[model samples]
Target: MGLLSGVLGNASEIEPGKAQADFAQLLIQGERVEKAYQLIRDSFVFTDKRLILTDVQGMTGSKTEYHSIPYRAITHFSIETSGTFDLDAELKIFITGGTHIAKRFNKKLSIYELQTVLATYVLR
Candidate 1:
């Protein structure tokens, strides 16, 4: 991701291997990370079994919170592709019990590919 995008607070893809390693302890026995995106210090990870969101807190960044949502809990999702004027793509995921998660991806990330990934799990 470009510095401009980062400055704008848009997310960019994090390497799968790195994400896997960083969130290893949070994964269950058979779960594996499929993809991950990072916005500043925090990350939202896509795993085979669920979605995991990480929020880094405190000035030292020691405090952290993790939210795990199973694919079965996802009610629906939507992806908005980047336009000529809108350089960022948007993704919105609605879960059971009225929870919503939204993220914006910079031009470096392919939102269609993200849609496919979500479809693979959520549609199953």
Candidate 2:
């Protein structure tokens, strides 16, 4: 299963308002810890499948496609309670990697947005 699916499965009972607040905090701090694994996966680098090339022999190269390759990072995260009964949790993440480019591209979204989107998906 995908990274988001795994995290959502673990967070099935998460409270809505609490989740939203936690998510907002996550965005402020960094990409949510829960979403970090997926972010890495989604941001994996691979050769462009659409790249075209012709060999010297006048033969066309085969279309090649690859997905999800591991990259390294120095990452730290914290999970804290945001509400009573442990129904709310906030996650903060800090990551640095020489080979990782996702953060540079700013492709990640706030946890609040991710939570809302997940909730919507579940409802549907």
Q: In terms of lDDT, which candidate is strongest?
A: 1
Model 2, which residues run further than 4 Å from truth?
1-71, 97-124
TM-score of 2: 0.21
lDDT of 2: 0.30
Residues 1-124 of candidate 1 have per-residue lDDT tens digits of 5667878879989888998888989998887889899888888999999999999999999999999999999999999988999988999999999989999999778998889889999999
| Model 1 TM-score on a 0 to 1 scale | 0.95
Estimate every model's Cα lDDT from 0 to 1: 0.91, 0.30
* lDDT tens readout by residue for model 2, 1-124: 3345334322222343443353352233432222222222222111111111111222352443333221122243334443443333444433354332222112222446443433333334
Model 1, stretches more than 4 Å misplaced? none
Lowest summed-lDDT stretch of 10 residues in model 2?
45-54
User: Pick by TM-score: which candidate is best?
Assistant: 1
